[model samples]
Target: MKVVCSYCHRLLRESPGEAVGVSHGMCPECDAYFAKLWGGLKLGEYLDLLPVPVMVVDGGGRVVAASERLADVLHRPRAELRGLRCGEAMACSRSRLPGGCGKAEHCRECTIRRTVDEVHETGRSVAGARAWVKTDAGRVPVTISARPAQGFVEVTLDEPEALAGALGGHAPPSRR
Candidate 1:
């Protein structure tokens, strides 16, 4: 597989198989430019280069950081998404109950929650985990991959369209 900088279209390298993890790789020149643009390349900058909805969640499943794609998918400002729990941001029906977020029974079976928990607990990367999220319209199926990054876990989604379909062609409602 060929890897290129998603921002500058510079060729990075070619891999024999699929590129794992969150990076699309960056050339040295674009790297230097982005470093100055963002006051040094940050997690968000790397996330912005990804073509999927990805976020960095803390130990408790709170979104400590996210890409603009995640912000757009959730239909919330990037700043507002920072503190929302992963389930809440995705509008998981179980998360709306009194128990909230991770406390509900459905959460026990949630792949995203499980992957996040595993990464936080063991500091290992999880890939190609299929997650079914319950929403108002239907069950949304998505493929997720996660890796421990910095002090937070980097989570990426491969099926935003399936998630959109599950949400009935709309972004999930903002947290209350």
Candidate 2:
């Protein structure tokens, strides 16, 4: 039988010989799921999207691709964020890590971080994620999404300006 990974939620493909009395023909559902999961995460060249900040990681969840938007949301340099640990990149310093976001440690309690973790577990794409981030003014809701990014995970922040624009204020121009 084609099994879904409880850890990553990815579908396990069963060969004809392995299919036997379990699942029927090739599982197209799982195949499609994998496609969307991976495509949505791939970054840089493949898709020309809006200015929303995006962060992509590998299977290990390391930061791989970070767009202009991610840098703004995280309040860090885009160049500095590349190749850093996922936890470190988003959290920045020790102050931003475990218990950095909420009562729970490791940002697991943070909805955006949790969505990314869920996508990693399913090997599937997580979409339309909306989160109320804790900011100086108050809690601000921002939309986001997660997918596989080649060897890493890809996440895009949406409508972040409307809710928490006051957090960072404005973004500088990028030549690229």
> By lDDT, who's the top model here?
1
Cα lDDT listed for each candidate: 0.81, 0.60
How does model 2 fare in lDDT?
A: 0.60
Write the residue-wise lDDT of candidate 1 on 1-176 in tens digits: 67789788777887666865434778898878777777755678777777788899999999988988877776667888888889988878888988889888778888889999999999999999998888887777878899998778999876677676665465433331
Candidate 1: C-alpha RMSD after superposition: 9.4
Best by TM-score: 1
Clashes of each: 0, 12
* Lowest summed lDDT window (length 10), candidate 2: 94-103
Clashes of 2: 12
Q: Once superposed on the true structure, which residue ranges of model 1 sit more than 4 Å away at CA? A: 1-39, 168-176
Q: Supply the global lDDT for candidate 1.
A: 0.81
